[model samples]
Target: MPEREILALRQRNAELESRLAQRESDDNLYRFLFDTMDEGFCVIEFFDGPHGPLSDYVHLVANAAYARHAGIANVVGQKLREMVPDEADNWVARYGAVLRTGKPLQFEQELVATGRVLSVTTFRIEPAERRQVAVLFKDVTERRRAEDALQQLNDQLEQRVAEALAERGLFAELVENSVARVQVVDTELRLLAVNHRAVKDFEFLFGHRLKAGDSLPERLANFPAERARSEAMWRRALAGESYIETIEYGRGARLRHFELRFNPLRESSGRITGACLFIYDVTRQVDEQQRRLQAEEALRQAQKMEAVGQLTGGIAHDFNNLLGGMLGAQELLRQRLEQGRLAEIPALLDTAGHSARRAAALVHRLLAFSRRQTLLPQATAVGQLVKDMVVLIHRSVGPAISVQVQCDAQLWPSFIDPPQLESALLNLCINARDALPAGGMIDIKCDNRWLDDSTALALDLPCGPYLCLSVQDNGRGMTQEVQEKAIDPFFTTKPLGQGTGLGLSMAYGFVRQSGGQLQITSSPGAGTRVDLYLPRHGETPIARRPPSEAPAQVQRAAARILLVEDQAALRMVIGDVLEELGHSVERAEHGPAALELLESGYVPQLLISDIGLPAGLDGRQVAERCRARFADLPVLFITGYDQSAAQGDGRLPPRTQVLLKPFELPDLVDRVITLLG
Candidate 1:
């Protein structure tokens, strides 16, 4: 071989060796990248077929991450439709796009099978050994969720800032226009600006109008202390602190409490520029506090008065019992004396009976004053009720007081105890008569008035329309102090023995128990006016019917009557009254005895039992037991109490009759006859 041929072959062999080494290095680098990449990678193969429908792309290969995300045990050489049939249509479209264009495409989508939101990148990679497209998918759910949450937070912050700005605008307007004193000042404690109230108050105190650049500490002595507190407050506020404080002002001239506020204003640079001061005159609030204290004191006094009233009521109750025994025995003795041969003693016995009757009246008045009297209220016409009391009032006032009534033709009827109203009217008439040295006209009027919301608020009472019954006297009126204490029990300016000082109190209580309000308005020289506001019931008012010329005849009944009373004197008196009415009467001293009497072959047709018995069984329980035995039996109960037990709790049978104690003998007889029939 020649030397030149050897050199050329050697060069060609060296070039071939270098090319082989470089190709091996490139292969190793590609393999490392394909195996170690974090993002999921895969190849999707497509085929063109006659069906014209695209066959689902086949998964030539898938990385471990993408395989696990799809919950696939093994994804190598699997068709996309078989691995994720639900997502096959989407994969086929992307695969076709990549294969047809032989270009890369990128989009974002959520893979439901993997429960992952992914950013996907697909590209056509014409493999040297095979034709296929590689796809890359990366989970981006966390990043997307964080971005959405950040957007929501920004939106909420903007909304809150807008609301705060709105509130600030309103507050600024309020501060500028408010009657309270408001001002803005610099750190040097010079007055920058002030509301009209500040100018007026400061001028009133110092006799000078405050202006900008005015030293506040010199004009107002309180400004020094206020400024000191303001400085400390602003310092803390600018240092990222929030503060709220209340301080007192104007101590020397007049003791007035003003609400003082110190707030800092800042610029965008977060530096404090000035401070705002808000001063509110709390005089009305102070006055309200004082009034509340006074009301509390008055409530305590009222509680004490109530305690005294209870004691007085107990005494009156005992007095009524004594009066009962006395009146019953005296009447019995007088009746016997009238019938007996001891006829000469008739006048003496009559005089004694009159005294006993007076004693009973006194006891009744006492009970009324103590508010212990049981009230029996009924539907009553105001016009007629007032008319019925005219005669008695005329006689009681000794004809000196002329009664004049101006009743509205459409006056609403009232539900009240008739006797109590009569007493109240009579008491007012007498008082009016006494006020006038000579005769005077007493105006008694009833009218319908609606108390709307404003009217009720002015009166400081509940809101509702009510019927008003008013009495006005053309006589000397009481002073303001007297008017204030007029409804207090036993409080009177009259001579001690001349009055018990309970007439108005009883009237007030009766109205209250009737669910009405009693109000009095008077002045020293103006005649007194008393108004009773009662809740109006929407029912037709019944007028008084003319009485029949002849009295109605009594209806007869064969019902036997049981008279159970512990007091012997009352028992005998009641027995006599019942017998005279042509009825068989069986008497028992107590409830147990009455039960025993009934058990011992006495089936009384009616049970009339006294409530207050010495034995254990009360009238209500006796009625209960009797009702249990004979469900349809009629029971007439008489009691000093209000008989609330019979009214409530369904203890008494339906249609049970109850009569208050100390009723007249005639009244009792009439009730018994009515109930029996």
Candidate 2:
């Protein structure tokens, strides 16, 4: 056998031994990995079963981690039915597909018996004869739960986004379709949003187009006034001051009116970021109101003209009757005097005198109704005045009509003419009596009132305290037409000659002249009420001393009187009358002449002057000039003209008196006597 042959065989034997050792080592490593692997591993062998061919399988082998994942210990050599009989068919059908198709499959399933979830992978063993499948799985329940939760969160977020987009779209639509102009601006006055109406109106008003991101003021730059004003209002809104405004622009045919509402635009966190303006055109409404005001004014003017015409006609008729009476009486007296019938002359003279007195009385009432008569206003206790008249009223109205007087315990004092107020009260009472033809009740009420601004405005009087004296009668009352003209002079409901038509008019005038209002409230069959609201004098009145019933002393000392009359006839007549009264008289035709007499050291005890003089100075001026020299001179102003200044607000000089013209000689003498005393 040779040495070379021995070497070759020895080498081959060593190579075979090395290959066997390496194969054994690889087998041990594979076994160790299979047992300690975290994933559960198993092999299922299929076989013929009761359900049919290859209907079930048994666990041929399982790794150590198989029990932890599948919760089944000693799973090797266990049939699927024996291990989980309730769901054996389900497992067999799932793994049997791998054997029949020879395809690998991967899936996760719950092991109900162990209450564990297993992720399993299976494939058929290589040989068709060997019906087997291998599976690798892990308990993936926690991972599946986390993935489901993430998916739900993603769905909610998507839904929220969709809702937010829908809301924004709705808001935009609302603004665009609004009839009024709507715009939103940032703090920088930049246009953030604007509706179609706002854009169109802005173009119409300022002849400029509007768009988002454009500065509003810049668009109105050419119209400086509108720009400045609009910016001011916007700034206020931006500063958190919400307000409303009415604006008018243009003139005549181009005039337009608009109502604007401004509000601050705020974030959801309540931070003011900008402002919004809403504007509505109200040109038609404004024009209608203006037309209404014009129509009302025209109606007022027409009614005023109608009243004037009525007043004129009434005055002409009354004056003509008085004139005819006086003229007829004078003619009769002249004829009787020519015939030398002294007895008939006295009767004719009496007739003429009676006519003259009636004419004078008519003139005085006319003056009172016109609020032009002389007034010596002083604080008066009107409550006591009304109380004093109750007895007279009761007697005048007869026993048929019941008379009642009610006065406030703390009635406010009033500034008014005492004689005029008494005449007014008596006239009102007499008028009330006439209303109650079948005898009704007459209620007199006097109360204090504090007029607020609204009441004062309605009554056309200043707001303040007032004294209210009312006369109410339960009679037939008056219609609206009659009540409206009830206060008019010479307007009466009674038949001719029975009523003078001056009672209510005189009362109203007297109340008005004393800074008061006269209101008449009446309705058909609701009775009549006349309320006199005189301004409160704000002071307690002095107690009035009762007049003595005794006559004035006839035997009085002579007084030196200065007669400053513009009319020569009046001077002569007045001078002669003073002389007849045993008084010395000096005459002057004008104020300058009278002052000259006074300057020449002729100081008269009384100065009687006409208020409307012909020369440089009037009666008031003459008296003022005369008093400059003779500080204590007593003055008596005689006039038929308006002498409002001397008596207005009761501001007459001390020791001064006023007398209206057409006075009887006796009345003149009485006034002279009183002033001299």
Q: Pick the candidate with the highest lDDT.
A: 2
Against the hidden reference, what TM-scores do the models get? Answer: 0.36, 0.37
Instruction: Kindly give the number of clashing pairs for every candidate.
Output: 0, 0
User: What lDDT would each prediction earn against the true structure?
Assistant: 0.64, 0.74
lDDT comparing candidate 1 with the true structure:
0.64
Measured by TM-score, how close is model 2 to the native structure?
Answer: 0.37
Flag regions of model 1 displaced more than 4 Å.
Answer: 1-377, 381-528, 532-557, 576-582, 640-652, 664-666
Q: Compared with the true structure, what per-residue lDDT tens digits does model 2 show for residues 315-418?
A: 56656877888899898888888988878876766777676766665565445434433567888999987875564466566679998888989888898997
* Residue-by-residue lDDT tens digits, candidate 1, 1-677: 99899999999999999999776543432333334334566666676444245566567767666654455666787776666767777777777777777666767787776677776766566542344676666566665674474343221110001111223222232233333466666666676666667887777655678876876666656556655755666556445443455555455656566665555655446676556565666654565557655654454344334433433544455456656766666776777777884755555555555545455444444344334325667777877778755644555555566788877887777787766776677667766777776778788888888888887877555787677878888778999889989988667788754665666786788788887888898887678888877777666555433221222336576457888888898889888767766778999888898888768877777888887788798777777777677777788888765555445463455657877666655567666776676
The TM-score, computed over Cα atoms with residue i paired to residue i, of candidate 1 is 0.36
Q: Model 2, 272: alpha-carbon shift in Å?
A: 2.7
Give the worst 10-residue stretch by lDDT in candidate 2: 155-164
